[model samples]
Target chain A: MSTADRRRLLGPIDASPLYSDITPKVHSSVGEAGKSDKEVRKVFIKTGLVSNASGSSYIEASNIIVEVSVFGPRPIRGSFTDRASFSVECKFLPYLKQPQEDLFRGDTHANNNGRQGLTEVEHKISQYVETAFLPCIILEKYPKSTIDVFITVISTGNTTAPSSILNLTNWIVNCSSLALIDSGIEIKDIVTSGHIKYLQSEQRLIVDPLENEEREDALDCLVSFESLKNDEIVGLWIDGNQKLLTEELLSKFIKECSSMSEKIRANFNNYLLKLCEN
Target chain B: MQEVDQISFPPEVLSRIAPDLSLERHLKLGLRPCLRSFSEFKPIAVSSPALEDEPNLVGSSIVSHGQTKVICGISIGVVEAKNQSDTLNQNETNSQDSKSDGEYDAEPVYPVVDIARGRTGAPTEEEMILSQRLYEWVLQSKIIPASALLTNPGVAIANQTSSSQGSSADVTILYPEDSDMPDLFSRVKPYKFVLYVHLKVFGRSGPLFDPCHAALIGALKNTRLPRIYVPDSSIYSIKIPIRSRGNFGHRVKETRIFIDENQDLSNPLQLNKDNIGGASNYGLYDLSPGSTSMDVDPNVIILADLEGDAEEAECMSKLNLIYNPNKKSINNISYSGGGMVLTKDTLKQCFKLAKKRAENTQ
Candidate 1:
């Protein structure tokens, strides 16, 4: 074929096909009829799973599973005289599909231009993890060194639903904290994160939201708190159109997330106690 | 008319206008959006070895100032001084026979800084700048004297003797068992160490240089290197084979130094107190016993650590000074942005403030 004809054959892409049309039938209630709204999914945590890493943890809840590994307080080869460096890396398994574009449509500007290697979602999640855990870690304790946290999503719930990203981020934060603790790194307090979606239509806030329940039109906020402290928020990430959100609604959502965080903290403490016994 | 209609302003242009107007309004009112004063700094707390439970680390510290938090960790590793001498020989031969002072003089310690913030594949520009500045400040200030890190007294003497006897003697000394005088190799050889500094800053507080500086200083002060003893010749004789690509297939045999882990850690470097009384030896500052009165007006206000609104103001004058209270001298001074031309009297005030803060923290 002629070069021009071959080039013309590869025409400008007009549209891409949807990955799946069979949206898992939305369940009106995930648990018992009235209990679904108040109930959060049970969290399962396991640590020291990765043999080579200095510390590692795996977290599972509902259809989501995340693994995090902590390495170092090892020497780094640059000219940093004062303190140890801390970094976070996040990756999603290839089997998992990317979140629907519509969910992140309003936040196009938020994608940093300089992050060339990471997908937009991976970059966002890693940044969130770094910011949330930064306050809890005693970085200055190791000078001229680096501590790296690597997080991988083994599996995730259906991504077509809007809440998948939020769920993934929350699990990453929790999993990383366990891994850091496992590595015997000195931390100020355990960090527990929770995701909440505000359903404006029903005027209800859903804590630890499931994928099918996340309404695209609703506002969502993911918050992480230092559990031992007085609910001092270490990291917060909000999504959805701000124009659709009111100050009162945002405050109410925050309060709901804060309360939900307490429950998650209790679960973490129980897990730690069990870990110590062994 | 058609062209003008088609020229829609980019969204970024419209977004930038709003924040600029708000910032300008706040600046005019002499108020920061965070409600902090122009001269006021965020609260700062420095904890040495920030994590009490991690006893394995050599040195660690956490510095939280305002909304910004930074953690610093220090790790040390030994590298053979022989490899350094090879490079020194090349450099000297290339430079027309310049004096080859020992390995330490030929290759100065270069600490690495790795900042993990946000999710970019490569190191961010801010990380690079902060790392460079911290490295420069530490070296220029001579915070830790190079001599203080010499492996051990025995190693230092052996190194001096071998260098004086030429390259053949150096080889014989390193592998004394091969020579007739096996007894000479009985003592352990001293080695040089490279210190690695890692810093992780949380929150996107502007101007990280100051917080990182404070955090690093705290970690260095708390650092205690372990006392390592050289193992016996039997251990050295057990050579590990290393593959090498030669015209004929070959394996290179090398001796390895074993560290005695049972030995106790050496005393902390004590950078703050080492040169306090004998400050004239270093010559960086002329703060001798009777030289407090300044011939030059040192009238700058050096803000040791700046954070929050004061950092964001961008226009306010800020100076970062590293003060050595024990020596009663200013080690290093750096500043950024514009306004408030500093007189010598202002510089003196800055030194006084830095000294006071350093003393209070100690």
Candidate 2:
């Protein structure tokens, strides 16, 4: 059938309404286990999860789970002779509630309208990871080739809470780093990420705040640091009600978040040693 | 390790390899395979008021340069902002009312863009990115002034006159008080319009943004909004009589308005000239009072449109500039891709060329 005839055969298309649901109530100020605000959640990491992939790693923190697979140093079709091209693809299972649309108000423009396999949030996440990791990779050694990193958020905690998304993103970065290392690719250093939240109500700073403990108005910052590069921050994303934060407070939060990354980096190194022994 | 054996080079490997060698050879000579200079743009042909037989579309255009072709069509609809009470209840439940502040902010009219590449089923990442970039560029560049989409332009004129006493040059030309003008001043309620831009790219050009932008500009230039007559009472209560012309029908209740497909397509809202007196030649709508006119510097050359081959070559770094044809100044400038640092002189030349191109096309 002709395109128009096919369209006519189908009923009137009701493009899904942009505003799908109202923001749910913030359930509580404490987490499920009544975890303290300062206590960082324990992270579980596994390497070589995908035998077929060049390198693969899976990480779980509380209810958040992410898996990363790395492939290549394989020949690239184009004339990328000077350096290797890097590409990242991030996907969230359809069943998960994608709250990313709500965080950035008026994201009506970003909606793909069920057009792309990857949602808008997935695109942004992929782009973010690609940018953050591009500087560290030794691309010149793999000239005319490409490295592909695939990240999958198998499960995420508290989709409604904005902090959970940040937490999930941090886990993805950490997992990808482990996957790249396991792949035996030439690299700079291991990268670890951490998130810190500034609670406005109590005027307190919480490192690695749980989903429930994330205040709607709290200032949240997520920073990724290179473990061996003197804790140099490779990526930083900050968002919240900016009007509530002062210059001093914002910088202070960054400092604390950067320091928190040191701990994550050390733990990641210990995990790497454990994996090698096994 | 087993999956590695199954992996194969993409089918385009041969085509890509040949082009890279030739593209580099030509770049050394400062010429493209098409024999165009580094700064020269490919021949661009834009057909506006296209698809006139299709009554549903308000404006449509076809833009082509070399092998790249893009078709842009615009559809207009009236949408009411969601009720405040529903959000207020949600806010009350949350206790922290700050999150609801977004509701009070002016509702922006988001233009939906659908790009159809070779793939039919789902939108590719490239398409999504292009749509988003187009949306942002349109808004950030203020290409379509918010005031242009008003239900009643007469109110805007009155507000302009009262706000700025003697600086009435812009408003007088936009809404001329003439016999042919519709008596929309009697309506107290104001309405906003949503534009859905449907773009279809025929071939896989290196970058689709430039062509899409030009086609959108051409299509928007060709667009004509209809004069809506809102009835008193709930729109649902009134049964709209089907009409033959342009699809335009609307009904208004206490706070809600409903529109049907009964528009007068014959009488469309004009973009180049005033509909009433047909005297003033103000291209598009007038600039709001107190807005500064953009100044174009005349030194550099602006590549108006890039062809497929040129774009694939050394044109790694691209700057897309949107200009106001009437004011002779740039409305917005966006930079994409990364390579080759542009100098101040080159930047100025780009804007000058953009302004020149806008004038020629309009």
Task: Kindly report the docking quality category of candidate 2.
Answer: incorrect
Local accuracy of candidate 1 as per-residue lDDT tens digits, A1-278: 11221111111121111111111234342323343666777777888765546788878776676778788778888787577788888865432445654343222211111112556788889999999989888888988988999887645654445455876798788889889999998889999888887777787777777744555567778889996788889988887655678888777777877787788778878888987898
Give a tens-digit lDDT track for model 2, residues A113-163: 223357767876787788879888999899898888977665565454555
lDDT of 1 at A215: 54
lDDT of 1 by residue, B132-177 (tens): 6666766555545444554531211123354443332232112332
Model 2 CA lDDT for position A20: 20
- For model 2 the local lDDT of residue B276 reads 8
| Residue-level lDDT tens digits of model 2 in B1-362 | 55665644442452355655455555455555556775555556778733322223567777875556566766544543234343324335333323342222222223333442212244566676777766666554444533345453222232333444333223221222343545544443444455667675644444666677777767777777654333322111334444335865543322222222234422343232211010000001111223343443232223335544533454555676666766556666667655344567667666666666666655
Q: Which window of ten consecutive residues has the lowest lDDT sum in model 1 chain A?
A: A7-16
Candidate 2 overall Cα lDDT vs. reference?
0.57
lDDT of 1 at B257: 34
At residue B355, what lDDT does model 2 achieve?
61
What C-alpha lDDT, on a 0 to 100 scale, does residue A107 get in candidate 1? 23
